[model samples]
Target chain A: MSHGRRQKPKNLLMILMLSPYLLLLFFFGVLPLIMAIFNVPTKSPSNPNGGWHVIKIVLHDFRLVPAAWHVLGFMALFVPLMIFFVVAMSLMLDTDTAPWKKWVRLAYIVPACISGSVAVLLWYVLLEPTLSPFKGVMHFFGITQASQIWKTSNLTYILVFMAFLSLAGQWILIQFGSLQSISGEILEAARVDGCTQFQLATKIKLPLIRKYVIYMGVLVFAGGLQIFVEPQLLNSSVYHGIAQQWSFDQLSYSLAFDNGNFGEASALSLMLLVPSLIGALLVIFKTDMFEDVNFKSPKKLAKEAKKREAAAA
Target chain B: MSIDFDKKAPATPEAPRKKKRKISIGHYAVNGWLIFWAIFSVIPMLWLILAPSKTDRQVSYKNPLSFASFHGYIRAWKNLQDFNSGVLAHWVINSVTYNLAIVVFASVTASLAGFVISASRIRFKKTFLISTLIMMLVPPVALVIPLFIEMNKVNLIDNPLSVILISSLYPFGAFLSYIYYSNTIPPEIYESARLDGCSDFGLYTKIAFPLSHPLLALLAFFAFVGNWGNYFMPYIMLPSPEHYTLPVGLGALFFSTPAINPGNGATSVPILKPEIALAGILVAVPVMIVFLISQKRLIRGMLAGSIKE
Candidate 1:
C-alpha cells in the first residue's frame, strides 16, 4: 500500500536525525555503565575469595563508612537549608513590587561566576581571618587564626557554606521563575478575597509550586550526594589530608588512581549510582516533571475531539 | 486558609489600607533580608577582582577591602607567563577549543534528536526519552572511571577529541530541547508541511531549526559554562599538564603556589595570592562575558523549561 511505502522514508528520516545523539549516548553514557558492571573488582589470587566478593570488599572498606557518613551529613545540612531558603527568598522576591527586583535577581546570580574550584579558593579567603573581608565578624567570634575556622570537625559546615553560597542564587532564581508561572488571575483572586501577602504566598502559591520545590529537593539531594570537587580540591590544595576521601566520589577516585584498584572503584561507583537512579526514577514517575511534553493523554484528546465536533455541528 | 479568613472577615473595604500598612513594614524586612544575602553573594566576586591588585604582604596585612595598584596584577601576569614555560595560555586555548566543539555538536545533535522524537512517529520513543532522562541524572563523576577505561581502549584518553565527544553528549540539553519543541511548536505546522510534500529533512531545516534559535543559544551557552567549569572529567581524562583545561591548569597552579597553604614555607617563584587570584579571575572572565551578553535570553530560556504551559 502507499501508506506502507510512505512510512519507510519517514522512519529513515527519523533514524537519520536520531542516530547522532543515540550514537554518542551509546558510546559515552550507556557503554561506560555496562563496562562498569563488568569491571567491578574481583578477588585477587592472593585473597582467594569468591567471584562477586569485590562488592563485599568495597562495602567493608574502612573509608567507605566515613565517606558515606560525610555525604549523608552534607545532605542533611544542605538539602533542608537549600529548600527552606530558596523557597523563602523566592517568595519574598516575588511579593516585592519594588523597582530593584531586577537588580536583586542579578545580584543573586553573581556568585555563580565563582563556581567549582574557584569557590573553594574564595571560601578559603573568606574563612581565613587574615584575608577575610568579614574579619570583624570572625574577631567577634573570638577567632583570630585560620586554624580555628578550618578544623577537622568543621569540614561539614565549611563544605555546606561553600556549596550553599555557590548554588543558592541559581536555585532561588529558578524558583522565582517557577513563581512567575502561577497565573495572575489566581493571585488577583486571592487578593480580592482580602488575603494578606503572607496568606497568599503560603496558602495558595506554596501549594501550587509544591512540585517545583520537590523537584529542587531531588536535584539538590542528588548533587549534594555527589559532593566531590569542593572536598577534593580542598584536601589536595589547602590543608593536605584535611578532606582526604571526605566524600564518596573522592573515595572512589582515590581507589582507582591512588590505590590502583579499578574493580573496587567501579563497584563503589555503582553503589553511589543506585540512589541517584532511584531518585531520577521517582521524579520521572511519581511527579509530573515531564508533563510539559505536550503529548496529550487519551482523555484530553477525547475532550478536544468532543469540542471540535461540537464546533463543527 | 484560616489565615485568609481571619484577615478577610476583619475588613472588606478597609483591607487595602490595612494591607498597605502591613506590607510596608514587611517590605522593609524583606528588602533587608535580600540586601544582606545579596551582599554575601557579591562580596567574593568583588574581593576576587580586587585581591589581584594587592601585594603578598598587603594581602595578609592590609585591609581586605582596599585596592592598591595594578602593579601587583601586572607582576602576577608576568609570573604566570614565566611559569612552566607559559602553560596557562595553552590551557586557555584548549578550554576554548574543547568547549566550542562541544557547543557545536551538542546544539546540532540535541536539537535534531529533540525535533524528531517530538514531531515524528519514532519507534521506542519512550525508551529513548527515559534513557536520556537517566543519563541526564547520572552524575558525570560516577562515569569518569568507566569512561576513562573506554577511552583508553580506543587510545583517545589524552586527545582533545575524547573530552569533546564525551562532554558533547549532553542529555540534559536534549531533554530541554525535546520539551521546548513539543511544548512550543504545534503538530499542525508539521502536518501542514507534510501535506504540502515537504520532506522530513526540509521540515526540520526550514521549520524546527528556524524556530529553535533560543533553544540552540541556550544549549550552547550552558554547554560552554558547564564544561568550562568541569574539572573532574578532564582532570581524569587528560593527564598531561599541557593538555589541561583552565580549571585543571588552575588546580595545578594552586598546587604549586603557596597562596592558600602559607605554611608550606617560602617559594622562589612570585606565584602568590595575587597570582592565584588573578588566575581564578581569568577562569571566570569568559563565562561572565557570555552571561552578560545573553543575560535576558538565558533567564527566558531557563523559565521556558520549567514553566508548564
Candidate 2:
C-alpha cells in the first residue's frame, strides 16, 4: 500500500510531462489517421461491397498507373542518387583534412534554404536558357528553348535535380555529423594496422556508421515517394498542366478537392501511410538505430566497466 | 628472420612517405569535389538575389550572372507592394507569426516529453517511443486530406490555428529530443537532483531544460524552417489570401505573373521576372537568416541527437 502510494506521484509527474505531446499527437497524428481510415467509403451505391471496392476503385483509377509510375521512377532516380552522393560527399568531407571544410558545409546547405515553391521558381529561372547562368553549357548541348528542358520526358530528371540540391546538403551534414561519432581510437588502431585512408574509411568508418546510412536511406526513400512540391509547382506555375497529377500526393489532392471525393482521397492516403509506417517500424526495430542510447546512470556505467575489466583480467 | 626484419623496417618509413603523398592528392581531390558541389548548390540562390537587380528584359537578355542596378530592385519592390494592395506584407507577417507559434509550441512540448520519456520510469515508455518514431517517419502528405476535412468540420479551414496546431505536433522534434535527452544527460544527475528533494518536474525545469539549449534551438530551427517552407498544409488549410503564408502567396504570385511561363498571355500587372525573383528571395530570406545565426548550434544539436555517447 505504501509502495503504491509512493509510485502515484511519480506517475503523475510523468503524465504531466507527457500529456502535452500526447495530446497534440492524438489530435493531429493519430486522429487524422483514424479519420482517414473511417472516411473511406465502406458502403455506397457505386460500391456496395464496401472497403475492397474503394481500394479497387482507387487502384483502377485511370490516373493511378501513371502517377504510380511517376512516383516509382522518381524514387528510382532520386533515392539512390541522393544516398550515393550524400554518403560519398559526407565520407569525403569526413576524410578531408582542410581548413575550408566549414565553408564547404555552409555552401552545401545554402540551396536548402530555397525550398518548396521558391526552389521550383529558382530552378525555372536557372533552366530557362535565356536567363540561365549555365546557358553557355545548355547551348553546348544544343538546348536553346525552355520547351526542350521542360518537356514531359525530362521532368523526372528536373525534379530529381531540384530535390537533390535542396535535400542533399542537409543529409550530407547529417551523415558527416554521424561520421564524427566514430571514435578516434578505432581509426588510430586501423591506421596502426597499416590500413590506408581508403581502406580505413571503407572498412572501419563505413561499418561503424552503417545504421545512420540506413536511416538516411529509409528517410530519403519515404520522402521521395511523396514527391509533390516540385512537380506541383511546375504544373501549376511555370507550365500549365504539364505535370498535372504527376505524383500520388497530387492525385490525392485533386481527388479530395477537384473531384470532392474525400473517401477516395482518404483511401489513397492510407495506402501511402501503410508502407511508411511499416518501413519506419522495420528500421527502428531491426537495426541498432536506438541501441546505443545510454540510459543508465554514471555509477551503473562505471560499475559495468569495472565488471567487464575484472572479467577480462 | 633478421634480414627480413631489417628490410621491413627500412621499407616502413618509405611506405609512410609514399602514403603521405597519396593522402595529399586525395585531400585536394576531395576539396575540389566539395567546391564544385558547393558552387552548384549556391549558384541558384545567388542568381535569385542578383536577378532582381535586373529588369525583366535584362534578366533574360543580359549576362545571367551580372548585376544591373539597384533601380530594378526598387521597381520590383514597388510592383510587389502594388500586388493586391500590398498583401505580400500581410503574408510575411502571417508567416512569421505562424512559424513563431509552431516553434515555441513544438520545442517546449518536445523537450518536456523527451525528458520525461528518457529520464522518468514511466509506464509504456517503449510504446511512446515507438509511436513517436512511427509518427516521425509517417509522410505528412498522407494526413493532409483527412486533416483538412477535420479542420473543415471544426470550422478551422480558413483559420491560422489549424495550420499552427497541426504543424506544432512535430513528431520529428519530439523524437530528436528523446534521443538527445536519453544520450546526453546522465541518469545520475536526475537521481542526484531527486535525492536532493527535486520533484520530477523540478528535475526537468532545473536540470534538463537549462542543459538542453542546443536541443531546444535545433527543435525551434527545424520547426521554423519546415513550417516556413511548408506549402501543402497552409495552401489547403487557409483559403484566403489574407491568411496565406509566404510559399502559398508565392504560388499565387507565380500564377498571376507571366514570369516563368511566357506562354501565359501578358497581364497589365508589372509582376515580371524580377518581381517574381524578388518574391522568391523574400520567401527564402527569413530561413536563411535563421540558418546563418544558428547553424553552429543546429550542427551541435544534430550531433547530439545522432551520437550515441
Candidate 3:
C-alpha cells in the first residue's frame, strides 16, 4: 500500500528520458495531422475552410471514397479468407511435430520478412503473358493478354494473391504463438473425454484464442484497407479494372506527389484517419491488450521442463 | 481404478478395436496438405531466384525455371552496376547507411521511452501512454501526405535526414518496448534503487539497459528489415536517383515501365524480363538471410512483442 504514498515524479529527468518519444510523436504524428487540416484550401472572399471543399469534392466527384471502397471491399472479402487459413495452418502445425513440419513452417513464414513489394514484383514477372513462368498453363488456357487476368470478374484472384503474400507469414506466426499457449493438460483432458478432432478444435482451441483472433482480425481489416504497393506497381500494366486511386493511401500519395494537390491530399488523409483511429480506440479499451508479457529465459524453461519430466516419470 | 493421464493422453484418436491402417490415413492427409502448402510458398521464390540467371529469351518465351546460364545473371549484375553510371551501387550504399541509422535511433529512443514509462514515475503518464498506444494503430498511409508537407516546409524532402529522423519516432517499436518493460520490470526494484540513491539515468544505464538485450535485438531487427524494404517513404521523399534506397530505386525502375539498362549507356533498353526478377532478389536476399538466421527468435519475439497478459 506504501506504493500509493510515493512522491510525484514530475521532474526534468523524467522529461529527458521520455523526450525522444515525445519529440517524434510531436513532429511526425501530431504536427503532420495539424498541418494537414490547415493545408486544405477553399476559395472564398476571406481565405478559410480548405478541407470541406475537398471533402465535398471527394463526396460529389466520388474521388476518394469510391476508390477507397474497392480496396475496402477487397479487404472485407480477403480478411475472413486469411483468418480461415491462419487458423487451419496454425492448428495443423501445432497438432504434430513431424520432421518436415519445421522446414514447412519456415517456408510459410519467409515471405513475411521480405517486403510486400518483392512479392508483387515476383508476381509481376509470373503474370506477364509473354514472360510468365506459367506460360505453358496460360497457353493451355488460351489466355492471350496479361490484361485478361485482372478483369473485374478475375480481380478477386489478384486481391487474394496480394493479400496472402503480405498477410500470411505475419498473422500465421502470431496465431501459432497463441495456439501454443494452450496447456497440454487441457488438451489431454479433452482428448480423453472422447472429443473428436474437429470437435476439439471448435469447442476448445478456437474459443481459447478468440481474443487474439479478434485482435488480428481488426488489425488486418484496418491495414488491408490501406494497401498500396500491389495496385500502385500494377499502374504500368494493362489492368484498368483497378482504379487510379485503388487504395486510400495511394489516392493520398497520387494526390500530393503526382498531382501536386497537397491541399486535397491532406483533406483526403484526414477523412480516412477517422475510421482507423476509432477502430484503434475500440481495440485498446475493449480487448485485454497492452498488458505485460513476461518471458522466461530458454535455459530456465528447459530446466523446468526437465524437472516436470522427472516428476512425471 | 484410476487411469494414468499420460497413458490416456490423446494424440491420434484411436479406438481399441480400430485397425492401424485407419490411423495412418489421417497422418497421410495432414502430411499431404503440408507438402502442398510448402510447394505453393516455395515455388514462386524458386522461380524468382532461377529466373535471374536466364536470358530475356529464356525467361519469357522459353522454359524460365530451368537453370541455363550464370552468364545471364553475370550480365544482368554488370548492367545493374553500370546502370546510370553505377547508380544502383549508390542506392545499395544508401540502404545500408539508412538501415544502420534507423536501427540505432529506433532502438535507443523507443527503449529509453519505454523504460521510463515502465520503471519510472513520469508526468502525464496516462495521457502520454494512451497517445503512444493510439498513435501506433493509426495507419502510416493516412499521414504520408501531411508528413510530406511538413518535411517540404522544413526543406528535409530529398534528404536522408527526413527518413532517418522520422524512422526514429516509430511508435510500434516504442509500444513493443513498453510491453517488454512492463512485463519484465517489477516496481519494487525501482523503489529500492531510488532508496539506494541510484540516479534516474544511473538506474537506466546500469540496471535497465543490461536487462533489455533480447528486446533491443528484436526492435533493432524489425526496424532494420522494415526500413530496408520500405518503398513508399523513400519513393515519395527522394525525387532523384542519387538518393534512392534499393526498394525506392527498384520501384522507379519497375513502376510504370521496366527500365533495365542494356549496358549500351541507354537508361531504358528494358533488358530481358529476367532482370526484373533479379532486381527483386538483389534487394530481398539480405533481408531473407537475416530472417533465416534468426528464424526461431523472430517468431518468439513477435509472440512476446504484442499486447498480452
Candidate 4:
C-alpha cells in the first residue's frame, strides 16, 4: 500500500481484498433488506387464482405504540440497571481496592457467557411459584406462587429486568477493558487531590470513558427495542399473560409464523431497522471509533501536510 | 496494554501525608454495592447448578442456593435424554456441527479479508470499511425475513446448510481481524518479507497465520458462543425437529413440559420440572466452558484493537 507518492487505492485491489466481506454483506444484509421490500406477493399462498394482489401493510397498523409501551416498560429498568451494574462491577473489578477481586469478577462475568434462553429459563424456574428454589422466601412473604405475582399484574417486567441482569456481564467487560486503558497517573492525581471514591468514579473515570458509555448506550437502545427470546420463552404458564408480542421482534415473529404474512413481517422488520440504523449512525458520527482508521496511512497524511506547507512557501 | 499503577508508586510519598488517608465509609459503601450485585449476578448461576439437583417438589420448598441430592441431576439427565426419543441428542449434534462450521468458515473468511484489506494495496478501502461497519450495525433481525425466503428459494430450507451459509459472513469478526492486523502486523514485517521474496500467499500463511493465534482464539470463541446461543435464525430456517439447536430445542422442551407449566398447551409429553432445569444447565455449560478457556485471550484480543485506537 505504501508508495513514494500517495494515491487512491486501486479498484482491482479493493475488489480482491473486500469481496468476501462485501459478498456476505450483500447476501445477508443489503440483498435481504431489498428482497424484504420486494417480498410483496402477487397472490396469497392459499389463493388458487394466482392473481395480482400485491400485499400492502403499514407500520402504523402494527400497533407500534402498544408494542413500544411494552418495549419501554422492559427498557426503563433494563437500560439504567445495565449502566449502573456495569459501571459498579467494572469499577470494582478494575480498582485494586476490592476484596476477593478474582472470584467476584468471575461471578460477575458468568452471565455474559450464558446465552439468552438458558439464562431466562434458569431465572424462570427460580422465580416460578411451584418450581422456585426460592419458595421458602416467597412463602415467608405470603407469596406462594411466583407466577401469582406476574399473573395479576405486569410483574413480568420486573422478571425480565432481573433476567437481563446476568446479560450485563458482556458490556461490563467491555467497559472494564476501556477503563483499564486509562492512564494510572491521572487517577492517582485525582485521588491525591482529595477526591472521594464517588467523585473519582463520576468526575474522572466516567468522563474519560464517555465515548464507550455512549457506544454501550446506543447499543443498549438497539438491543432493548429488539428483545425477543425472553418474551418468546416466557410466554407460557410460568408467567402467563406477559404479552406474547412484547417487543416488535416478537410481533414480527408471530406475524410471520402465525399469520404467514412475510410481507407484513418484512414491514415490521424494517420498522426496527430504521431506529437501529440511526443509533449506529449516531455512534459512528459522535464517537472516535473510526478515527484511527481510513484509506490513507499516517505517513501519507504527513507527506500531504508537508507538501501543502511547501506549496504555500 | 493494561495500565499499571507503577507511576503512582513513585509519586505517592512525595505528597504531604498530613491528610490521613483512611478507607472511607463511601469506599466500603461502594464495595458493598459491588459485592451485592456481584452475588446478584452469581445467584442465578448458582441456582442453575443447584436447582436441578433437587426434586421438582424439593426445588419449590428448599433454599434455592442449597445443594440437594445428586440423584436429581442424574434423574433429570435421564428424563431429558428420554424425551421426544432423545431429540436433545440430535440438537446437540446439530449445534456442534453448526458452531464448528461457523468457527471455521467465518474465521477463515474474516481473517483473510481482514489481512488483505489491512496489509495489502486495495482500492475503495474506505468504502469497503464503511460498508462493513454498516453491515455490522444492521440488526440481525432485519435480515431474517429475506434470508428465510432466500434459503427457501435455494432449496436449503430444513437443511443445516441454510444456517451455515447465513452465518458464514461474520462482519464484526472481519472488523476485529482488520483492527488486529492493522495494529499488530507492523509495516516492517511486510517490508522485510517482501525483501526476502515472499509471495503474497506465503506471507499470509507463514507470517500472518502464526501470529494471529490470540485473534483466532478470540474469533473462534466468539463464533462458538454466538452461534451456540442463536435461537431465531435456526428457529425460522429449520422447521424440522431434528434440525433444532439446543436453544430452540430447549424452547420446545419448555413448551412441552406440563408440570413445568400446566397452562402451556396441555404439556402433551409429561416431563418433570427439574428436567427442564437440567436441560438449561446442558444448554449453558458449553458456552461457559468456552468462555472460561478463552477468557484471557479474548480479553487481551479485545483490548489490543480497542484501547490502542
Candidate 5:
C-alpha cells in the first residue's frame, strides 16, 4: 500500500514536469514542422480540382532539386575554412604558457556573445565604401568600392565569413575544453623526447582531441548547412535565389509571410526537419559526444611535467 | 573477493619546481598579435560610443570616428519622445519587463528541468536529451513563420504575451542547466539525499539549487542577454511601435529617418546617427554588466567542454 502511494505521486510529478515541454513541442515544433512539410504544393486558387496536383507539379520540377544542390554547393565552401579555424583554435589551446592565450580566447568567444543581426549590420556598414573606415585602407590596396560582396556572385564567401565569425567561438570553446582534458604529462613526455612546439601541437594535441574534433566537426558541419539569417539579412534577393526555398527556413518565411504560399512555405520548413532529425539520430545512436570525458588529473599531469622539467635541468 | 583489505596506498610527494626562465621572442610576437586583435575587438565599441554626437551632414563630411552634433541628438531624442507623448519610455519599460520576466522564468525552469534530467531517477533520459539538442539546432529563423502562424491561430498575434510566452521556452537554457547540473552537482550528494528521506524536489531545492548558484548566475546572464538582444522574434510578433523592443524600435528609428544615415556617406553626418549610436550603446550595457558580473563563470563554461562535464 505504501509502495503504491509513493509510486502514484512519482508518476504525477513526472507528468507535471513533462506537460509544459510536451505542450510546447506539440504546438510549436511538431505542428509547425508538420504544417510546413505538407505545404510543398504550388497551388492555384483558380482550379477547384487543384488539391494534390500542386504537389505533383512541385515534384516533377527538377529545377527545385538543383536549387537545393546549389545551396549544398554553397555549404561545401565552408569545409576548408572550418578546417583552418578548428586547427588554429586547437593550436592556441595547446599553448599552455603562451601570454596571448587570454586575448586569443577573448577573440574566440566575443562573436558568440555578440548578436548575429548586429554582426550583419556591422558588416553592412563595413562594406559601404564612403561610410566605412576601411575604405581608405582598401583604396591603398588598389581596391575600389562596388555594390558590396553580397550584391555580387561572391555572396558565398560573405556568408562563409559570417558563419565563421558568429559560430566559431562556441566551437572554439568546446574544442578548447576537449583539449584541456588531455593530460599535460603526455605533452611533457613528448617534449622530453625533443618534440618542438609545432609537433607537440599537431602530432600530440590534435591526435589526443581527435574524437572531440570529429564531434565538433560533425556538429558545426550540420549547423553551417543550416545558414539562413546572415544570408537573408545580407541580401534581400536571396528570397528569389535558386536555393530560395532550400534554405529551408528563409523560404518558409518568404513563402508564408511574403507570398502567402503557406503550403510551399510549410513544405520548405519541413525540409529543416530532415537535418534536425538526422542530428537527433546522431545525438542518440551514433555518438557519445556528450557523455565521454578526456579529463584526466591535471594535478598529476602538472606534477609529472614538473619533475620531468627538473630532471631535464 | 577481499583478502585482507588493509593495504595502505603510498602517498606521493610534490614534484620539484623547475627554474622559471626568461620570456622568449615568440611570446612577444604572440602578445603583439593578441594586442592587435584586442584593439580590433574594442574598436566597434569605441565607434558605438562616439557615434551619437554627429549630425547626418557632419557624420558624412567629417572623420566618421568623430562625435555627432548635439542638436541632431536632441532632435532624435524628441522624435523618440514624440511617440505617444513620450510613451517611447513605455516601450523601454516593456522591453525591460519582458526581458526580465524571460530571464527569471527561463532561468528557473531551465535549471529545474536541467537538474531533473541530469540528476534524476527519470526514465527516457536519452530521448529527453536528444529532443533538447534537436530543438537547440533548429535555427530560430526557421521557426518564425510557423510560430507566427501558430500564434495567430491562438489569437496571440501582435501581443506581448506571444513574445513573453514563446521566448520563455529556451532550449539553450535547458542545455546549460543540464550541463551544470550534471557536472557541478555530484551524483554522490543526490544518493545521500535520497537516503535521507528527501523527495526528488527536496533534493533539488535544497542540494542542487544551492550548489548550482554559480551556474544560475551564468544562465541568468545568457537568458537576459539573449532576450535583450533579440530583434526578429519580437519584431515579427509585435506590430505596434508602442510594444517595440530596443533593437526593433531603434531599427525603425534608423531606417525611416533619412536624417539618420545607415552608413551611406563617410562624412554625410546623419542627424540622429549619434542618438542611434547612443541607443546601440544603451542596448549593449545590460549585457556588458551581466558579462562583467559573470565573467569568471562565463570563462569557466567556455573552457569546459561541449557538455559541461
Candidate 6:
C-alpha cells in the first residue's frame, strides 16, 4: 500500500479529508466515554460505595434482575409468533408460490411502515381494560374481572402486545426482503429435482435465510430491552410495577429528570449500555451472517465462484 | 436506463407454466391468519380516533368500542391549546426546535464522519469504523449516566441545548451514513476526482455529497422521527415544563389524569382525563405526518442495499 513520490499529494489530501472525523471522534466519542468511565469511580450520591457498588447493586437488586428477566420472558412468549409470521410471510412471498407477490409484500411492510407513536396510541384503544373485546371474552369466561384487566398481574400481556404491534411489521419486512434475495432459479432447480414447496422451503430456503432470522432475532431482542415509550405511555396509569423508572431506561429517566439525580441516572444508563454493546459485538463478529443478510458478502461468493470454475477447467 | 429498469422490475414470467390454478386450503388458512392479525393491528388505531369524543364517564359507562360525543375533541383541543394559556403551543415549538437542531447536526456530522472515513485513506479507518459500531451498539440508556454527569458538570441540566447536544451524536445515523458512503460511492470516482486534482473536501462536497441524496433523505427522515418520538432521553434532559417534547408532554398528561386514578370509582371524584381519542391523535400526529411524507425515500433506501446481493 506504499505510495511513490506522485502519491505525496494524494496522501496529503487523504490526511486532510480525515482530519474533521478524527477531531469529532476525539472530542465526542473518545472524550465522553472516558468521562463516563472516570465518573463511574467517584462515590456520587447515586452510588455511595462507588462504581463497582453501583454495578453490584444493579446486578443484585431483586427488582432489577427480575424486571430484566420479565422483559426477556415476555419477549420469549412472542418467539413462536415471530417464527410464525416470519416463516409464513417468507413462504407466501417466495417466488415459487405467488404470481403477484407485490401485494403480499405491501401487506407485510405496511405495519412496520406506520410510526411507532401511532401504533402505541392505536393499541391503547384496543387494549384499554374496560373496553377491549378480549376483556369481555375474559369476563364471560370468568378468567378476568374488569378491575384486573391490565393491572400489574397482566402487564406482561400488554407489554407483549406492545412489542408485537410495534415490531411485527419490521420482522416481516426483513424476512420478506431476505426471501426476495434468494434466486428463483435455485428454487426452480430444487423443484426440477422433485423438491416440494414445503421441502424446498424447509430444506433450502430455511437454511439460506437462517442468518437473516438470527440477525433479526438479536436486533429485536436488543430493541425489546429498550422498550420505553410504549410501556411508559401505556402502562403508566394502570400498572404499579411500571415505576417512573421501571426498567433500566425508565429508571434512568427518573434519575436524571424526575428525581434530578443525574449521577444515579448516569450509572443506570451505563448499566443499560452493556447488553447493547454485546448485541453490537455479536453483529460485528457474526461474519457468517454479515454478508448474507445485507448482500454485502459478495467477496466470499466470488471466491467460491472462482474455485468452482478452476475445478471445472 | 432501460437496462436498469429491466433489472429493477421483477422478472416475473409473462405467464405461469401451468394453467388456471386452484387456491389451496393452506392459502385460505394463511390469509385467515394474516387478516386476523391485520384486524388486531388495525382496530386500535380505529379506537384512538374514536375514543377522543367521549368523556371519561361516558367512556366507562358505555362500551369503549362506541364513539363518544364530539365534545371530547373540543375538550382535548382546549387542553392542548388553552391549558395554562396555551403552553402546549410552546411545547410543540420547543420540540420542533430541539428536534430540528438535532436532525441537522446529527445528519451532517454523521454524513461527514462517514464520508471521510469511508472515502479517505484514514490512518485508523478500522478503529474509527469499529468505534462507530461500538457506539451504535451501546444503548442510549448506558450513555444517559455519562451524559447526565457531563450535562450537570456544565450546568446544562434542564436545558434544551443539553437535549440537542446529547442526541446529536446518533450512532445509528452514523452507521447509516457509513453504509451509504461505503456501498453507494464507487472508489473509481474518487480516483478520478484525485486525478483531476480535487481536494478531499472538494471531492466530498462536489461529488460524493451530491451522489448521496437518497441516503441523506433517508437519514433525515429517520433522525427527525427518532428524535421526535423519543421520550426517555428528552424526558430526562429537559425538565422544564415549557421545553417538553411531545412524548414528555404526553407522559405528563397521562400521569396527571385523575380519571385513571379514581380508586374503585365508588369514592366520587372528578378526575380530569382529557378525551382519550383526541389525546391519542395528538400524540401520534407528528410521526404519522412524517411517515406519510417520507415513506418513498425510506422504502427505497431500505430496499436499495438489500437487492445488491
**Considering every candidate listed, which one attains the maximal TM-score?**
1
Please identify model 2 stretches exceeding 4 Å from their true place. Answer: A42-52, A293-313, B1-17, B23-27, B192-197, B266-268, B300-305
Instruction: Summarize candidate 6's per-residue lDDT along B72-133 as a digit string, tens digits.
Output: 77776775566556666777788788989988887887777767766765455556667776
Q: In model 3, which runs have C-alpha deviations exceeding 4 angstroms?
A: A1-10, A41-51, A136-144, A150-153, A237-243, A291-313, B1-23, B255-270, B305-309
Model 3 chain A is weakest, by summed lDDT over 10 consecutive residues, at A42-51
TM-score for the first chain in candidate 2 comes to 0.90
Candidate 3 lDDT by residue in tens digits, A129-184? 66666777887998768667756655546766767776687677667767766766
Which regions in candidate 5 have their CA more than 4 angstroms from the true location? A35-70, A98-100, A144-150, A169-174, A214-219, A234-248, A292-313, B1-31, B66-91, B184-197, B259-272, B292-296, B299-309
Clashing residue pairs for model 3:
none
If both were scored by TM-score, which would come out higher, candidate 2 or candidate 5?
Answer: 2
lDDT of 5: 0.61
Q: Which of candidates 3 and 5 reaches a greater lDDT?
A: 3
Q: State every prediction's TM-score relative to the real structure.
A: 0.93, 0.91, 0.87, 0.89, 0.79, 0.82
- What is the DockQ of the complex in model 4? 0.48
| Candidate 3 residue-wise lDDT at A164 | 77
Span of 10 residues, lowest total lDDT, candidate 6 chain B = B1-10
The superposed Cα distance between candidate 6 and the true structure at residue A172, in angstroms, equals: 1.2
Judging by lDDT, tell me the better candidate of 1 and 4. Answer: 1
Q: After superposition, how far is residue B302 of candidate 5 from its true place, in Å?
A: 6.0
Docking quality category of candidate 1 according to DockQ thresholds: acceptable
**Per-residue alpha-carbon lDDT of model 4 for B1-309, expressed as tens digits?**
333312222145744344334555555766677777777776777788887788877776677678888888888888778788889899989988888888898988888888877777655666667767766666676677778867777789899988997898888788888888888889689779867867666667888889999778778877777788888889889989999988888877776667457665543344666777777777787777777665555555544444752
Question: Tens digits of per-residue lDDT for model 1 on B174-234?
Answer: 8888887887789899999999999999989999988988788888988887888888889
Candidate 4 versus truth, CA RMSD in Å, comes to: 4.0
Ranking by DockQ: 4, 1, 2, 3, 6, 5
lDDT of model number 6: 0.62
Candidate 5 chain B least-lDDT 10 residues: B1-10
For model 4, the TM-score of its B chain against the native B chain is 0.90
Question: Quality of candidate 2's docking, in CAPRI categories?
Answer: acceptable
Candidate 1 lDDT, tens digit per residue, A88-142?
Answer: 9999988845667777778888777777878888999999988898998999999
Model 1 chain A lDDT-worst window of ten:
A41-50
CA error at residue A130 for candidate 1, angstroms: 0.7
For model 5, residues B1-309, the per-residue Cα lDDT tens digits are: 011111221221332122113235664565565555556555555555555566555655667677656675676566556643665587689889999888887777777777777665555666666667677655566577667767877899888988887887767777777776766768888878767887777777788877877778877777786788787788789988888887676665544444334343232333255555566655765665565455445544543335332
